[model samples]
Target: MRDSIRLRTRARLAYTACRRTRCSRGSLRELSAVAVLITALSSACENPLAPELCGAVADQVVPAGGAVSVRVCFNDENGDGVSLASRTSDGTVATVTVRGRVVTVTGVRGGTATVTVTARDPGGLSATVSFGVIVPGIVRLTDRHGLMPAWSPDGTRIAFLGRVPETGDTGDGSIFVMNADGSGVKRLTKSISAVAPPAWSPDGTRIVFTTRDFEIYVVNADGSGEANLTNNADWDVYPAWSPDGTRIAFVSDRDDDIEIYVMNADGSGTTNLSNSHGRDDWPAWSPDGSRITFTSRRGDDIDIYVMNADGSGVTNLTNNPALDLWPAWSPDGGRIAFRSGIPFSADIQVINADGSGATNVTNNPEYVYGSVPRWSPDGTRIAFTSADRNNTEIHVVNADGSGEATLTSTAGTVFGDHAWSPDGRTIAFSSNHSSSGFHVYVVDVSFFGKAAKRATR
Candidate 1:
């Protein structure tokens, strides 16, 4: 009986030890009740942090010393707030700062980096996501057929001819305006048959363009107040605004032949400036508004001609037997840049304002043709379209005929009609790089080292 009593005591000690260690429950009902209590506490906690981010994250490209903000959202599953943190994989390329859930990344140098964002809960649970950032040498502004990109006088917007997606008809194009970086694209005209790219007024308030019906129209920058400037049935095209915004020079065939004409800003006082027998067209104005330059087929071959604003003192700038067309005046009005030779096999030539000392700025043997040379605002470099046997690309050359470089090298692409921003920091052009016909694109000119080469002649 004493041994049995000792055994019972030892059993009691063992039962106490099992209860302390949570290894045994007295009954099945007790065990189930304890489990229910633990599950209730866990349900109350409810995993306060969510696994997925709530906001949109996009890969970004910024210039050196530029900054962009990225926002992310994290939902708290248990109705409690959370905190977010961010880190950059390469701080030398960019630096990140987190204020609440928004991460601001500033480009520090030229490279690429990855940014990771973490969302954390009070219970020490967290989740992470990452995105890429690139400091690119070139940034493509548009992905559609954007032709003839003309920058606004203020340099904040660009105007171009956008080819509408063809439904069933062949000719559906309109004028469009967008930011310099290819954002905020707004259609400035409805479905109209635009024949040329729109030209902005000196005041940046209005745009002038020619339609396929050979009519000159002026529309407000906001796509309002569209009025036909030349309502005549004749072909009135190639509208250019005078530097002072007081007059518009255009090409018209009203007198049975194409000639240069100038009118008041309100489309009044229309007078023939280049009333000649040969077809005179493609008028460009001097920056000082003292003269007008145009392409004419008056002599044995087509050439560039300059005349006074009032149509007197007509002088041939390029007396070349080969074709010389599309005379673009330099920003300082010191030189004229034009294209020589036939289509697809032309070279860019620059001449003095007084029709002397002409030089071939792009003497490239591989480039069969160069079209429409546009001088940068600083007049140091000229941008034009060069075509080889393979494809056409945009090219830049020093005004003195040195340091010629192909700015674009896309295969099977054709690029043309480039315009420079007022500050000469960027160039806007049209390209078919995506095989979708023509779309406008803008590239950072700063990436092309030393764009400022003075005219040698």
Candidate 2:
């Protein structure tokens, strides 16, 4: 029965130099490096010398109770068959059991485990192969449309935009919050049309978001004490909290042009930070809260810029002719990561905070940046979406752009708005990968580059 079970790895196969007479990169949209999936009805390669364990096992991202099975067998040119035995290195994350040559692995929790399978012939000769299974520190928090997830300062709750059931594909929703474990979901705001991403206050008591009709609102985390901060007729959106929690930075067209603006925690002391005629948006606060980084088209080209908290000492960091967008500061406040080449995310590049050295980390044109580059909590790695073949996937890379690993290579698209857990062990993002509406999901980053390699890698 084991000999008849065919070996399949994920949605597509990418084989390197091992026994491969041909190796080409997998197509962007259809490839996933998630697991060494099992199929039926094919024989593995024959081994004339001894019982050779055939096929390979790769890493997997399964939910807490999910299960994946792999077929194990030995190629015995000699007619003697073999018996199979399988064991898990860590039973806490996953459990393995073998029945007739099929090894079924069940995920226990949010962790990782390695499974090793041994095939022994009657002569006492045996062969063994092992594969790693990552019961991903991952969870799909929302079953419906939930976008722009923001972690509360205390990391206990996540604030996001929940789509109104009646509105489809309009990118509008009411603000909501849920516990970090995805339970205790509660609605906070009632903005039914075109609600921008929500931002949490530093003290974790309140949230801020913008509406499609050009207004900004702040409300308590429990859905009380709602106030219109920017009760204006002009546009106001893209609000960001300062590191010190004293101020909020946002973009407004009240000046008759789009520019960066800042306001106090309350609805007072509104200040215009970037008073440029060119478009300036996507403000980000440095780790120390001393400066702000944003992207602008001030010089007839889109580039990243940094300025003091008070809107002084403005300097252009990228200065490139290409459209540079989404400037993200490292956790240590030493460097910045942004997308260069095209708005569709051509490449992810990093530059020193002082605007001295700029380097391209992901130079491949195929790995289109899905959104802004997000830095890990330790500032050691960056996560972004890749449209390798126009399939939106979440990927992680070393700060230096090394050790790139494909985390979610689903057949569907992984939308943006990814947020890291405060402890940095998990990342929450939005995706339509499960053949459902866009929902919020989280993946434990424990699988970062350490997971099993895919034959299609």
Which candidate gets the maximum TM-score versus the true structure? 2
Q: Model 1: what TM-score?
A: 0.67
lDDT of 2: 0.78
Error of 1 at 20 (Å): 99
Please identify model 2 stretches exceeding 4 Å from their true place: 1-137, 164-172, 191-194, 447-457
- lDDT string for model 2 (1-457, tens) is 4443323432234433321544345533223332232231122223334577666665655545556777776786555688889888889888999998898988777776778888777767777887777766557898667887888877788888887554344434788899987899887765445367788887888888887787888889999998888888999998888977788999999989899999998879999999988999999999899999999988579999999999999998878788898999999999999988875548888999998788888877766785889998888999887786656777788998776665664567777578887878788887776766777888878666553643310
* TM-score of every candidate relative to the true structure: 0.67, 0.70
Candidate 1 lDDT by residue in tens digits, 1-457: 4544454455556555667777745554455555555444455454344545675466555545556787877776655567888889899888999998788987776667878888887776666777776653445677666788889999999998877655555436688888887899887777567878788999999999999898999989999998889998898998999999999999998999889999998899999999999999889999999999999998578989999999999998888788888999998999999988776567888899998898989776667756678898888899887777877776777899886655555554555467888988777877666656677766666644522221110
